[model samples]
Target: MVTGGFVVDLNKPLVSQVGHLGEAYEEWVHRPIVTKESPRFFASDVLEFLTLTVWWAVPLIWLPVVCWFVSTAVQMGFPSRQVAVTMVCGIFVWTLLEYSLHRFLFHIKTKTYWGNTMHYLLHGCHHKHPMDGLRLVFPPAATLILLMAFWSLVKLLTPPSVARAFVGGGLLGYIMYDCTHYYLHHGKPTKGISSNLKRSHMNHHFRIQDKGFGITSSFWDKVFGTLPPTNPAEKSR
Candidate 1:
């Protein structure tokens, strides 16, 4: 039962827990949140559909931008090799950032009203509704914000030539991470790295939330001691 936007666990009784919000804990974890029907967000059907489907366009849209930035960096007096190396380092850096955000930011626990709301908005929604096809990918608005912040930070700290190459490479890495994440959720890969990633991600979603934070690569998870243990059943399959 819901009262004042909070789900009440009937057995527990609202009177027994006076100060605490009566929101059902199980609902947050197990229920599929129908975004279209939520009055709180006032989400439009068209917008929800677009956000879910925008992953297909991300590579096409960003690849050209990345290429242009790299080319412009080369023209700005940076050695081609140095630009390439810097770009590769940027990609490497993104993996760690991804892991950190997933583990620390997205999955952060909170007791306050606003903090829990923010967590649900950012990531808990995905965990609760994993098969919601439209919700699997990052929406363009959020992506643009992240990209702008990263690019600005890179530019602020480095020479223009180096910053351009770094930002371009980081963007490329981010695009790959998002795409790979979507694929792990929706694609069928029977063998090799894709299969491995898919399995680990499923484990993260269903069995263990604290482990397997890396979606694009397990290297960081291994480094941070958060890698999910290999189950014997998974090994035979």
Candidate 2:
């Protein structure tokens, strides 16, 4: 049965999807199970990935890596094992980044002007308008600005060459996080590693937003004492 992916599709343009393979449509064509017409935006002949999803990703797909390479060259540091480590860690680092951003940046309930403004801009917009696909991921220009800021910080803390690796890794983490987050909210969860990761991430949307803030892993939550409570009952299978 069709399970997840763009649950309650909202503001989604015409999408070309087979409504639940066969069973769902058979019910629609015959039985017409109307438990109350949901606001869910499915049932269309046009393609969703092409129409609604793919266009939202164009800026992310080509924008960051282009900047990463050009910036790396300009920084005068030859890529090395440190760079490789950064790439590996960069992917893992996104979990921490995600956790921190969600817990601190997004979840800020401060009454102060700056803090409340930041919370609204960074995450409140997404929470209120989750289906604005283009707005879901960090835009290219904003991402570049962040990359510059992070690179500056890394450079101040290390040598040029080392900083290159460190910053590159961190940037890599951001790219992965943005992409995965977008895909999690947009694409269908498959049946492998991607599926597992997608489900784990999507749980944040359903169960508890305040907890389980890691996108790539629970590593950060474990580190910071924010991991969700144990649920052995669901895993008993």
Candidate 3:
């Protein structure tokens, strides 16, 4: 089925077609899904199109960068065990970072014109067009900027050895998070943890927006008291 500029497949199980409801947030979701592609702000159509679509390419692109960081640190004479431990710690730290960014930054409400525009561009677009496969994953351009910022932070805060290992693990965590998010939105999982994650994410989109902020793991949501109710009765309500 085609609506607005977006192509929707009737065979695919879409959780919601209804628009997002909120003050200053009425236009996007309510707007008809376009059957034709939306034009880009950028003059370069290829770059613009590439920015909107990201999937496996992002992780694959980052893998070499992550490896170089790790290997370079090891070459600087860091103990193998220490590097491993640091990397593990960085991965653990990523869960908190992911939860915090999704809950606070992405979900932030802005009243100003520019603020709202930026907000919509950053995340509200996702809520507005949830099934748009192209916009489902983070753009590699944006990811690179974040990587630079994070790399700088790690280097500044920790020793060179620890920084390298930390970046590697954090990169892995982010890749996993992005892949899992894409899977939950598009993949079919009849049972197990994958199924649960799909359900939780769907609920966040369609039912309880404030709760269930954790994507990589529900642990942070549980810890922060944001995990949405899971009981069958509660879900029906």
TM-score quality measure for candidate 2: 0.62
TM-score of 3: 0.81
Q: Each model's RMSD to truth, in Å?
A: 6.1, 11.5, 6.3
Looking at model 2, residue 217 earns an lDDT score of 64
Per-residue lDDT for 108-221 in model 2, tens only?
554433443344345644554454565567655556677787777767977776666666566667766777777776779769766766666655544445666777666787
Whole-model alpha-carbon lDDT for candidate 1: 0.74
Candidate 3 lDDT, 1-237, residue by residue in tens = 444344534343232221222243434433434332332323555755665766788677888888887898899998888888888888888889999999999988765546655676677667756766677788888888888898999889998888999999898888888889988877999998999889998888876777888887899999988888886357522
After best superposition, candidate 1 residue 51: deviation in angstroms? 4.5
Ranking by lDDT: 1, 3, 2
Q: Measured by TM-score, how close is model 1 to the native structure?
A: 0.80
Comparing 2 and 3 on lDDT, the stronger one: 3
lDDT of 1 by residue, 104-169 (tens): 998877655565556666786677667665666677778789989998999889999999999899
Q: Best by lDDT, which number?
A: 1
TM-score for each model? 0.80, 0.62, 0.81
